[model samples]
Target chain A: MGTTGTDIRYLVIIGIAVMLLLFTSFLLALIFNQRKKLKYQQSMEKLREQQQNQLIEAAVRSEETERHRIAETLHDEVGAILSSAKLHLLGIKSDILDERDQQLHEKGRELLNEVIQKVRGISHNLHSNILKEFGLNEAIRHFIRKIAQGTVLHATTALDDNYKTENPDNDISIYRMVQELVNNILKYANATEFIVSSTHRGNELDMVIFHNGDGLTQEQFEELRYQKEGLGLKNIQNRIILLKGSIHFTSGSEGYRINIHIPVKSNQP
Target chain B: MKLINFIRDWSEVWALLIPLIIILVFKPAKKQLRPVILYVFAGFILNFLATFMVEYYYLMPSWTYTDGYVNNNILYNLHSFVRVLFLGWYIISVRQYKFPFLLKTLLIFYLVFVITNFTFYESPFILSTRLYAAESITLLVICLFYFFRSMQDESDINWLKHPSFLIAAGISLYEVITFFIFLFFYPLHQKDISFAAVTMRIYTITFVVFCILLALALYKSRKKSNLSGVTG
Candidate 1:
């Protein structure tokens, strides 16, 4: 029996070896399958990203077309009528020669001119040709200048010298992203100083905005990531990622800071 | 010891021959081409090695041989070592043919520790043939636990529920019963407990049970495959 035990033990050893080999093969198959599945999932995610971008682009084009139509209507129809009305009023006031009535006519003409200018300004903000002509830096300057006139924002920008040569699509996206950020900052941050700066190091570009103001809580940031519509932040993230860039936001005791970085030359394709 | 050897040799012949006979008679459920190849390589290597270890490298058991000469060949132990490893993988991968190759290979290496046992050592004290059988069955049970869990559409297997597997399981139970006897009586006298009786009781019963179940399994699988072809 002892002799038989010795023989059986050998068989058991063989059995053990067989089991080990099979299990190893199974694990290898699992890893291979997992990688393949992950690759497929990544491709699907990429397709979804492309579809969302196409939708955003279509919306932007639709809005731009609408703005152009409005701008045309104001300049051609309303602007001509206002000018004609002003000329007629001046002619009439000269004929009257009564001081009080003449003064009132002059004041009325000035008000009419102001109204016409304000209407033109609104049309330009909707979609401006100046943005396309001078590129983003000058356009942003004009934008901040106009916003500053109304609010005590003191909006200052430090765009690098090479801003003109930026990728036009990226520039447009940056402008839109910044505009959204500023709108949120104005309404919610309750800040005093708003400074926006762009820095260039080799092929890399970094844009930062600093606000000396009340900051958001950790819970608010968590909500932004998890639940809230948070279209503004989401939009910012989408644009940066599309540009193959990165965006970071930090809340400090002093205020909140946001920074965006992108590799300019290498990421062109 | 001589009687036990006779019974064990008969049991092993039955284990291999019955499976062979069933395959010749009725085909498997699935073609089972892959496992067939793997099992052949595994079984051959394991059988050869086990024979070698018992016959040679292990402290020659004071058991009777053909010419009263103890065989000692390095090839025997080496092959036996390899066989144990192969069996480890076979039983583990026996349930599902989908186990990874790396795991199978690693399992083979892992089985080496079993030979560190006293069965192959100078003195067969702690790690005896019974202990080896017990370990093999336990591991096999663990490996097939999933196979026996529930019946699925592709494979309606419930090992615990299957009487056929229970027959194979008898092999394990018998080994355990013998181990207890050995443990109780071993200290007193080696000759008093008949090695012949235990081997006859264990191997004869276990081998017959294993052969019957294997034959049944082969028949069922063959019938299934034939039905599948007709339906298709």
Candidate 2:
């Protein structure tokens, strides 16, 4: 009986040691797995952040580019026409002082009026008052109509009325984001048909942009994500997140899909 | 003969009904309408009727229950039915997901085993009781592997966030413990094992521990779905 008791105690000690060993091993394994997963996630996040930085930078550059474009238009086209009109006015004053000369002066005055009208058209192109007065939906509608009729590509929109953003600046962001995505489609995605869907759930907005094109392969995507570091994609995502949103990209048999979810509080009045 | 006929009469109904309940209630995607309606439902119906025949006509309990003839009542038979439905769903899900070659081969192997379970020369006493028990347990393991492999690639379907894999792990580990008990008492009839049996008994206590872990994993997984921005 004493021998049996001794054996039992020995067995109990061995059991404790064995249990501790197994537990430590299991815990270490779990920790290792979690660490590996965390590393993977961090790497993925860094890639996205870098990509977004590029897009934001590009958006900022595009705004500047638009400024330059307008400046160039004003200087080159309008400036040249005004110079020509000044030359005509000078020519009439020196060469002819008769009634026939006065008639030529009237023609120059009419040409000046036409040049003013041209400047007004340029101002409208730079900042369409239709956007402020009509709201985003209508502005987008007009934009699409203009683009569709003008361009070979077909663009369609699906808007969810329930989704609204609390931040007023989001209106511009929304416009720009849509503009960027559509721009990508116009530039990159080859297939003709494209879709832009926005769903408005309470305090959240889900936007899906899909296009059929010769898209990047998974490896190509990863490579471009690291190597090319697109700025347009980044700007859209950063702007979305500024509205408290997240974005993801996936490619499958359907081609490339971009799903962006924006967390919002209230609608535009 | 009277007793045999009585059990046999109700056997078909129990076999069909029990499996039908399991398939309709427990099997995932039962409520799903399109595409999966006919395929999944058809399999459930056939498996249900097949079980009915196996229960009443094939493996009816005619002998005395005094020694070791299903120590539990008819409700215990649901265990058998659950195992069948579980395996049936496993095959369908695996086929849908296109499981890895290893798991597919294992499934085909299991079917072969089930077919041969009949040809095994058995003691008449063990035939009715242990045969189905053995089959159910073996299929459970195979089914667990099938589901496990299928889940590795099943990312788009996040309804329950991989609940099937969690359940499979829980059920499989539970059966492993229970199978040892069976092996000790009936299969090998090991009268005593000084150290090995002691280890197994201690291992059985950890079943609850593992179960708690499984539950926690499932709960965490559900919370993960909420963390994501998936639209309904």
Candidate 3:
């Protein structure tokens, strides 16, 4: 071949090489670009999850704080006034009153005492001072006593004595969650018998509520918790999340059961 | 009659005016589109001037000086240089951030090649066949890159309606067909004048097709903007 033929042949080879180089570069860019996009999506999903957890924590804290404030007001202001009224009634002399007046004084003293007791009970229910002073075991016992007085649910609890949490806030949240679950069993489960069991295993506290009646299905539980009428269940869920706990709901032919596991130490910063 | 033949021979030069006029009349809404339209218009003016100079030299042979000053071939070389430069600019702008460093290095190399061709390998008075071949190959590569880049884009706009895709398609088609013609121009022209003339006609036809595609791109861009304006 002549010089011109040789040059043309070289140009053809050069053209093929250029095309191959571009094609390879394009493939590499595409692969890297997709990998980068996937990473970005994962980071975005993580950020969204973090934001949701923070919101739930804030809500649970605010609700607990409000409950404490109301309880304090009832105990301090209302309980004091009623106690004073009962003391004054007690100070009235029998000789200064006719039979009818004496009878009225006695009745008035009895009513004042009942009102004082009722107010104190309401305050205690709102914020359990027993849970704060004593701990989770005493609080559960007190709760069972309160529930046993009103209903025929035949409630029973067995909490490990050694089980303790360093954070009272976390304990209150866990207690509230258990309280809500028990209330749910009482109101909806229609069970003749209910059981509450708690144990400390390793760094985790496991609490289970088991009842012998038909309860909500998993789908129903999820759906209900999102509904407007399921505020109580939603509150329980938020408290569990605040305590860095996990809850499982299971239903069988026998009954429904709720098992919750909370870490002894809170994971919150 | 001779003037008619001259016009027929340079039909691609005249075809460039069509897109230039259309783009100016429709006026793309995007500010970024202005550079592309301005370059196309510059190309049209350049082609028209080159054709005119070549025709004038042919008609007035007596006016030509023996001292190698100004001629048709030099004007053709200048036209090719400007066309490659503008097309490169368009591709680089469209690719934007996605344009690879390797392509940039290749562009620098192409620039150097053009300078060397004009200065040493090929004189201004001679047809720079090698440079034309290199331009076609480089442009073909750029057009293919545009295609691959467009494929990777997640834009909702229909690919068929995309202005850049349409322009790339047109450029790719032209380059694919004309590359071999440019590669073998010197040898073929040395062998037979008829073969060269036939190849030139094919070049004119492909050039006309490319201009039509560009005009369509401008029209699509204008329509897209109008639709967005009405909906927005």
Model 2 lDDT per residue over A1-269, tens place: 33353354355446446545643454345445545655666787789877765666566557746855785677577767786776766666534568776786787777776776667545454543455576656556666665566567777888775544365455656666776767667777776877778877777667777888765443443344334467665455457555656666678886788787776665456
**Model 1 lDDT per residue over A1-269, tens place:** 35454445444345435544654454344345545655666787789878876776666556557877898788777878888887887678455578887788878989999978977777676665677888877877787777777677778989886755456666666777777777788888888788888988887878887888775543464468455578776666566655667766777777788777776663356
Question: Highest lDDT: which candidate?
Answer: 3
Candidate 3 local lDDT, A49-153, one digit each (tens): 788878987888788889889989989988888887787778879788999999988888888888888888889988968998999889988997788786676
Ranking by TM-score: 1, 3, 2
Write candidate 2's Cα lDDT for B1-232 as tens digits.
Answer: 9997655544433433433353454443323212222323443444444445444443645543436343232322333434444544444453444435655565466556545653574433242334444644565555445444443432334322344444444444445444434433332223234544554455435444434433433343332222322221
How are the candidates ranked when ordered by lDDT, highest leading? Answer: 3, 1, 2
Backbone clash pairs for candidate 3 read: none
Stretches off by above 4 angstroms in model 2 are A1-35, A80-87, A90-108, A120-269, B1-117, B123-160, B185-232
Enumerate clash totals for all models, in the order shown: 46, 8, 0
**Which segments of model 3 are wrong by more than 4 Å?**
A1-24, A93-108, B1-232
Per prediction, fnat is: 0.00, 0.00, 0.01
DockQ of each: 0.02, 0.03, 0.02
Chain A TM-score, each candidate = 0.79, 0.52, 0.80
